[model samples]
Target: MTFKAAKEFNTPVGNYCYYHISRETYPIGITQIKEGNSVYIMATPEKALCDLIANQPGINLRYKKEALEFLEENLRFDMDKFCQFNPEIFLAYAKNGKKSTSILTILKLLQHE
Candidate 1:
């Protein structure tokens, strides 16, 4: 299997919904929302990411299901375009060692891309 020494996905267990990525050599796991965006990562350098979204004092807004679909369709792993903006995530995967480590987004695992 190409995913023999695969990576692990670090996401919230339930109510907490921030899918954070940290330093860990996992066999296989899911990090990003297997469905949407509005990634709710923790501001700290921790492995656990959760979505802490709430209405502001005056503004009342929420990430709708459609918005998530939009993100997945348009922004999901469009690294060719999005990397210019935030390159760290991509860099992390690139800097990964060839034999020692491998990073594959859940999408790739789906299509075996």
Candidate 2:
């Protein structure tokens, strides 16, 4: 997955592009998968969420309730799958990435779930 600016553009194939800036914002917990003759590398869901929070401007998830609302209402993130996310990834990202408050709140939300 790509992490650059928070702008999205429609591709010819109708897929939306989401990206971010800065090397520090690059995702963690990446994995590579091979299918047939092709290989693809992508970030884990935890890292992707962190990257989204850090790079997407105008988002304000300062409190746990706000973070939860953002996840449930704005992103419609599946709470059932929330249990599978690695809290360590969010912790690591909060230590060195932008949006520390929002990231930490997300981690706190995970812990209480």
Per-model clash counts, in order, read: 6, 5
Model 2 scores worst on lDDT over the 10 consecutive residues at 18-27
**Shift of residue 51 alpha carbon in model 2, Å:** 1.3
Off by over 4 Å in 1: 1-84, 97-113
Model 2 lDDT vs. the true structure?
A: 0.81
Q: Pick the candidate with the highest lDDT.
A: 2
What is the C-alpha local distance difference test score of candidate 1?
Answer: 0.28
Cα-based lDDT at residue 25, candidate 2: 54
- Model 1 Cα shift for residue 78 (angstroms): 9.6
TM-score of 2: 0.80
Give the per-residue lDDT of model 1 (tens digit) for 2-106: 224434455576343223322432212224433364663223211111111111122122333433343356435343432233323322443442211112232
